[model samples]
Target: MLSRPSGGAVMKYGFPSLSNIRTRESYVSSYDPRTRTPAWVIERLGGDTLGGNADRKRCDFKEDDRSDACVRECAGVSVCVCVCARVRAACTQVSACVRPCSVHVFHRATNGDYRGSGLDRGHMAAAANHKWSQKAMDDTFYLTNVAPQNPHMNQNAWNNLEKLCRSLTKLYANVYVCTGPLYLPRQEADGKLYVHYQVLGTNHIAVPTHFFKVLVLERDGRQGGVELRSYVLPNEPVDEKIPLERFLVPIETIERASGLLFLPNIVRTSGGAVTAAANK
Candidate 1:
C-alpha cells in the first residue's frame, strides 16, 4: 500500500485506476516514483480520430544505452492528470527544459514537437501548483504531462484557472486537480458540429480543441465533505474579461467527453460549484 502524506487524513487524488475507466481504448495508468502516487494517465488517439497510426513508438536507443531513453510505448499522449496541492513556500522558477519520456515514448511530448508549432507546451499538471517540493514541481515538466495548447489560452484564462486551484488551498486542506485536453465539436457552414483538432509533431500528437480542470476541495480538513468544481475551456484564445464561471460545466459533461471517472469514492450530490472569489 502507498503511504499517505504526514499530518493529514489520507485523501485520494489524481487519476483513478484503469478498472474505474469505462472506455478502455488507448488508455494507460502508471505510478510516479517522485510523487509517490499515480503520476498521470492518458487516452491516446489517432490524428484524425478515425483510428490511424495512434500507436506507441519503440525506443531507437541500443540495449546498453536504453535504460536512460524513452521506451516504445510513450508516443500517443492525448490527455494527462495529476493531483495538485498548494505549497507553503513561494513558487520557484524552474527552466522550461521539456524532454521526452524515457519510459514511455508516445506517453510524453518532445521539445521539438512544439518548436515553431505556435502552440505552447501547456502543462496538464501546472508546475506552479506543485511547489511543495522541487522534485514534485520537476516531475510536472515531463512531456507526458503536456499537450499542444494555444498560447493565448494557456497564458491567460488557463493560467487564471491554475491560480484559482492554488488559492483554494487557503480555504481547504488540499485541492485535488485533474487537468486534461478535450476534442470538442464545432459548428461549420452546414450548421453541423464536428469534432476536429490538429496534430503536432511526427509522432502525431493530438492537439485538443479544449482543456478541462476538475477540482475537488477537502474542506474543513480531510474529514469534512468535499466540494467539486469542473471547468472546460476552449483551446483558443479566451477573452480575459470573461468570468471563470462562464466556463463552468457539469461534471457529467467531462465524464461523457473524456471517458474518465472522478470522485467515485466520495459522495457528490450535485454539480460542483465555483464562486467569483475563486478567480481572484
Candidate 2:
C-alpha cells in the first residue's frame, strides 16, 4: 500500500481499493501491477480547477517510478552491468557499475509499446481537467494512469466524452469523475463466457475490452444535491454520431462490471438526495 496524500478532496467519495493507491497533484489512482495500468482514477473538477496555462503539448507519457520501490520495480528494471572498452595500447578498459535502474523494463508498458500497436495511450484522469497546474497535467501522463484504447474511439468518442466532463464544470458546482477499464466476459460460439483481451508489448499490458466513467455531479454545493451518471463504452471504434447518453448505464452495472463501489450512501449524507441516471 502507498501512503495517502495530504488532501482528501479528490477522493471525497472514497475509492475502490486500499492497496496500491497513489496520489497525484490533480487525481488519485489505484495501480494494477498485473495489468500495468490504473485500476481506477478519481479526480475532482470545477471551474477553478480547470483554469490554468498548463500545456498538454509540453507533457509526455512517462513511467511513474518515483513511488514505492516495489511498484516502481514491478513496472520494469534497469540494471547496471560491466562494459568493456578497447584501448589503444593493447589493453582493454573495463568498467563495472552495479546499480539498480528502473527506467524501463518488462511488466510495465513503455511509450514504445504503443508505437505500432494501433492503440492510443488513453488517459483515465484526463489532462484537460487538471489545468490548474503544469505538474497536475504532467502527472496525468504517467503510464499508470493510462490504458490502451482504440485510436478511432480515443480520438473521437472518448475525446468528446472527456470534453463533456470539462464542460460539466459550467453547470455543476463540483464534478467528481471516476474512470477505469473493464474486461467483460463474452459468450463465444461454444456458449461459454470468457474474459479475453489482447496483451501489448513485452510487458504484455492487458488491453481492456471496455472502459467506464462515473460522474458524481454536485448541484449546488458539496451538501447541495447529487446526480450520478455512469457510462460504459466498448474498446473498439464507436460511431461518433451516436449520442453519449446512449451509453448511459446504471451505477450498479458499473459496480458489478468493475468490482468497484461508488459509495452512494456517502453522497446522500451530504444533506441532499442522491439520484442516479435512469438505466437505459
Candidate 3:
C-alpha cells in the first residue's frame, strides 16, 4: 500500500496501480447559477457550507480587513505537498501583485482575444480552512484566487495532496516550511517576489517557491532567485501551521514516493517564458 513519505529522505515511486487514482467525475449534473459549484464537490472539498449558500463569513479583504495577514498566518510553514508536477515540480510563477490576473479580464483589458486557457486560483492559503466561508468560497471563484498555474498542475497537486493527507493537512509532520515577508524588500529590483520556505526535511532550500518547487527543480542554488524568511505566529495550533519549504530535496525522491516519472514541461526547454503584465 502506498504510505505517507516526508523529509528529505526520498521514496521510490513506482507506477501506481491504475485503479488507485479515480477518474474525475462531475459532482453536479445541471448547472445552477445559484450554486456555481456542485453540492457534492463542496462537501467533498470540505467547505463549511453547501449549495453556495451565503451563510458563513467570507474574508473581507474588501475593506480594512486583515484577510491577507490571516491567510499568511493560516498557511503557516509549508504544508506537505501532494500536488504532482509532471513537468518536474513547480509553483505559481504567477506573482501576487499582478493586475487583472484573470486571463479573461486581462484579455478584455488589453483588447486582445481571450485565450482558452486561464489562471489557477491557488489559495496560497487553502480553501477548506475555517477562514473560508460560503461567500469566501464563492469569491474564490474570482480570478484573483487563481495564480497563473498550468491547469493540470493545480488539479493534480491539490487533489493528490488532499487524498494523501486525508483532508488537506496544514502542518509539516515529516516536512516543515516557514514563509513570510522579506526583510530588505526587493519587490521591483528582481521582478520575482521572494518568499522563503524552510523544509525541515532538507534544512535548506534550492528553489524560489515552496517545498514542491525546490523538490521539482532537481537543482541547487538561489543565484537568480530571491529569499524571504517566515514570521512565527505565536501559540498557533500545530495543525494550522503554514506549508512552507522546511527543506529542499531532489525530484527523484518525490518520484520514488509517487511512483511517477513526471515529464518535463515542453515550453520550458523551448525558451518559452510566460508573458505576464508588470506588477502593479
Give one digit per residue, the lDDT tens place, for model 2 in 189-235: 99999999998887889999999998888777345656878889999
TM-score for each of the candidates: 0.65, 0.79, 0.24
In terms of lDDT, which candidate is stronger, 2 or 3? 2
Sorted on lDDT, highest at the top, how do the candidates line up?
2, 1, 3
Q: What ranking emerges by TM-score with the best candidate at the front? A: 2, 1, 3
Superposed on all Cα atoms, the candidates' RMSDs to the truth, in angstroms, are 13.9, 12.2, 22.0
What clash pairs does model 2 have?
78-101
Question: What is the C-alpha local distance difference test score of candidate 2?
Answer: 0.76
For residues 1-280, write the lDDT of model 3, one tens digit per residue: 1121211122211111221111111011111111111101111222221223343244332111225555565343332222232311344342222111112211111101113324233332234322324533444333222222334434554434433322322221121111111112125566976544221111111111211321111111332221111121111122323342332234344334323332222112211112111111
- The global C-alpha lDDT for each of the candidates, from Candidate 1 onward, is 0.54, 0.76, 0.24
50 Cα displacement, candidate 3 (Å): 12
Model 1 whole-model lDDT (C-alpha atoms): 0.54
User: Per-residue lDDT tens digits of candidate 1, residues 24-109?
Assistant: 11222343322212233432111112112222232111111114233333334222221122321233532221122333343334
Instruction: Quote the lDDT for 79 in model 1.
Output: 25
lDDT of 1 at 176: 66
Model 3 RMSD, rounded to 1 decimal: 22.0
